[model samples]
Structures are given as C-alpha cells and as structure tokens.
Target: MTGKRGRPSVSEALARDERVVDVVIALLTGDGIEALTFDRVAAEAHVAKRTLYGVFGDRTGLVRAAIRRQHAYLGDAGDGSSDLRSASRAILLHLLGDEAVGIHRAIIAAAALHPSLAQEFYDEGPGRAQGFLASHLRAEAAVSPELLFAALLGEPHRRRLLGLAGPPTPEEVDAQVDAVLRTFGLLR
Candidate 1:
C-alpha cells in the first residue's frame, strides 16, 4: 500500500505512469533537466522512491521515458493520415509550441553530457516528425522532406527554442505553412 504518510498507495500510483511522466515533464520544462532527480519526481508525483525506481530504473531511464512521452504526444501531429495542409500546420504548431521548445532547450543543455540521450531525442523527435512529413509529401517536389521540415520550423522555432519568442499563434503557423508549401511547389 502506501509507503509513506503522504504518498499514494503503490497500486494506485503505478496504475497511471502518465501522472509521473507529466510531473517529470513539468520539472523538465519549468526547471530544466537538472531538476529531474528521482527524489524530485517521486515527491512531486506523490509516489514512493521505490515506485520510480521500479518503474523507470534510474535517472537516465526516467529522462528517456519523459522524452518518449513527449515524442508520443508530438507524433500525433503530422502522421500523414490527415490532409497535407492540416498535417503540416499541426506539425508546425506542435514543434513550435512552448512544451516542445522547453524540452528541446533542456535536452540541448544536457546533450553535451548525455550524447546518447541527445541522439535518441533527435532520432525520435525531429527525425520522426520529418519522416511523417515526408510521408505526406508528393514525390514530384524538388525539395527534400528534410528541407521542408527545416523551413517549417525556420526562424520561429529558433526563436522559441532560444526563449526569444513565445509559441506562435495559429495565424502565424498558417502563414508559415502556406508560404513554405507554396515555395516548395506543394501548393498551387
């Protein structure tokens, strides 16, 4: 059952890892990756230390799980299942959103020390997103999907990742996606 007076019962706590990962996400975005210790996550999630370790193994595992969670959330956007315009807009908005930018900044700060984590982040995050965009594209376009992905992010993403700007509004996302699609000859 409960390991401590304030903590949730183990069965109840472990039932939804989302709660724990959500806490980790908040810590990651709000205080940067340095704040992702098991102590902090367990306390914030009201779970026991044993629960965190039993579920996520160690700090690296914990961080990896959080990154995976982020990837899962962002992966929904540009799945190629939707129409091109909608998919592209969704991808741009999600990529340039506050949480993605925060996670990106945190990962960038930690990447030098955790190269493998960074590589995994890139592979699963932007790499996967680009792959999705590629699937949505026609074969006739001269621009590679990678180039289109870059243009979608472009200056807005850079500004967001650097904390120089906030998340773009839907109108801004629309303008950027329309311009990029037009430039790439994907739009008429």
Candidate 2:
C-alpha cells in the first residue's frame, strides 16, 4: 500500500523490511556471510540501497536482523509448549531443522573474523532456547536448563553441523527428546 505522493504506507514498509531480511537469510545460507552486501542485498531484495542502510544501519545490523528473524521462526514452535517435555521437544526439533543448521554453519564460519556476529548468533539462538527451557524448568527444582538445552542438541546437532546428517524425522526427534528428558528424570 502507498500513501500520499506514492510513499509506502507503514504496513508496506514493514513488509518490505521483512522481504529484505528474507533475502539476507537466503544469501547467508547459500553463500555465507561474504555474499551479504548492501549492493547485492538491495538488488536481490528489490529495495533501495538507502532503505537498507536506513533500516539496518550497516552490514552488522543487517546480519543481526537476519539472525534474529531465523531464531524467532525456530522459537515459535515452543510458543504453545506448556510443560518441560513439550518445550524441550519443540526446541530440539526446531533447532535441528535445516534453516537452523545453515544459520549455525554461517555463524561459525564468520566467528573468528566477526566475533560480534558470533555473539549475536549465540544470544539469539542458543541463549533464547536456553531461556525458553528455563521458563518451563522452574518447577523441576534440580534440573539445569542450560544442561538440558545442551543435552537436547548434543551429538545430533554435531552431526547436522558437520553435514554428516540430515534433519531428523519426528520419531527420531521424539526419541532424542525422551532420552534427554529421561536422563534429567523429567520425562513423564
């Protein structure tokens, strides 16, 4: 939608911003961080370069936005999770998905050169996951949310990160979650 004089309405601007971030994520997952640039993203997103700068400030900001968006999508699965078991399973499944793995690979590749981006990735991804689990663990008394988060991902996530494995099926994810919950004595 456009307002007076052909200016984009607020909703249109936000939609365009989302489109730009989607382009950024695609670029990142396809070619890593090096492929992310104002020029290329502007062209791929079909938006003005100035708009990218205006909204994201610079390359780091753009990267941050993309990472956050990906994390949010992954975290959404946990929104309806009420108990520890459901939340743990949802978080594990979401984190093990292809997009999550690709984002993880991209961040790891950029970590040494861009420490801030690495930190951003941790905060948005694992940190948020840990916090999500923590909320559900409030009644577990002895269970450590951080440890549970680690255990949930464990070797499966390692295999995915190394490209030695594909996304696990629901049954596999359920088994992994049950095993981890059993280890924590939290399975019901």
Candidate 3:
C-alpha cells in the first residue's frame, strides 16, 4: 500500500533550504564559484537534486539564494541593540572576515560573466549593511550613511580585499569605529 504523501512542513522546508544555502556557501568559500554545482550542493547538503531544482529553479537561483543568505548572516552579526558603535564594529568585522572576503572576491571575479550575481551581492550585502547603519545615524548628522560606512571600512578593508592584511583585532575595530564617529561628528 502507498503511504500518504504531502509537502514538507514549513519549518522542515525552511530547514532544508537553510541547509542547501549553507552547503553552497561552504562550497563557494572552499573552492570558489567553479565548485558550486547542483550535484555537489545536493551531496553536501544531503538533499536531493530534484529538491534543489524545485526550490531554486536553476543554478543562478541557487547562487542568488546563497548570496542572499550570506548577506542576511553578515547583517545579523551585530546585536539587536541600537548602539551605533556596536553596529558599526559588527559590520566592519563581517566585511573583513575571511569568509566575506572570499565571497566578495568570488563575486568580483565572476561579475563579468554574471552581472546578476554582482548586483545581488551589492544590493543584499553591502547595500543592506549600509542601510542598517544609516538607520542608526543621528537625524542631524552631516555625513551620509554611505560616507560613514566608507570611512569606517577605509584602508583596512581595502587591505583585506587586496590580500595584504588580515582582519583587525577587536581593539583595532573599536579604535576605527571611534575615529569614524569622531570624524563625522556623530559621536554621542
């Protein structure tokens, strides 16, 4: 006799989707974009190929979803508190983190071939983070959130992207955040 069949519960579907995204991110980090095939993701995520196809439609969809998940993860790294300095430091640290750096490099290298991925990365990743910071900025602050984010990242982030240096220590992050706030006169 055949057993009853139905779609997975919402929580189950979410968990499976999360697993797929996690596997894609791991593949992207470990072997770059070249290694992120649906077969590999299915195997690593322990989900079926059909499930991936059904959920994401195609490789591009899967990649976009993974990038979006990465952005959400990075953006959520900070505590939920409204402290500007804390939020700024969290964004800086995430930008400089090894995984984020790798993802950034992969997107840049692949952008010529895949403009959609590049746009998604910018919109969902850095753009989202900047919006988060801008929300916390004082109403009367002279500097725009984009400018403030640039100053907060500045040379250190560039060095990380160029592979010339590692992420800053917590102390260095604090110093930079303080300096950025001071420079913008956004200090409390």
Question: Highest lDDT among the candidates is held by which one?
Answer: 2
Residue 10 alpha-carbon offset, candidate 1, angstroms: 14
Q: On residues 1-188, what C-alpha lDDT tens digit does candidate 3 reach at each position? A: 65435788899899989888888778777787778898999998988899999999887777778666545534444345657887888787777788788788887888898887788788877788788887677788899888988899899988998999987899989999999998888785
Candidate 3 residue runs with Cα over 4 Å from true position: 1-14, 73-80
Cα deviation at 69, candidate 3, in Å, is: 4.1
Ranking 1 against 2 by TM-score, winner:
2
Residue-by-residue lDDT tens digits, candidate 1, 1-188? 83445555667655558788888879888998789888889898877799789888887676777766655545555454676677689787777877777788888998998887788778877787777777777777788878988998899999888789988899999999999999988888
By lDDT rank, best first, the candidates go: 2, 3, 1
In model 1, how many backbone clashes occur? 0
Report how far off residue 170 is in candidate 1 (Å). Answer: 0.7
Q: Which ten residues in a row have the lowest lDDT in candidate 3?
A: 70-79
Comparing candidate 1 with candidate 2, which one achieves the higher lDDT? 2
Q: What would the TM-scores of all predictions be?
A: 0.82, 0.87, 0.83
In model 3, state the lDDT of residue 37. 90
lDDT of 3: 0.80
Clashes of each: 0, 0, 0
Candidate 2's residue-wise lDDT over 1-188, tens digit each? 65354568899989999999888888888999899999999999988898899899998888878767655634544465477777877777778888778878998999999898888888877887788887777574577778888989999999999999999999999999999888777876
Could you list the CA RMSD of all candidates, in the order they appear? 3.6, 2.9, 3.4
Model 2, runs deviating above 4 Å: 1-6, 73-81
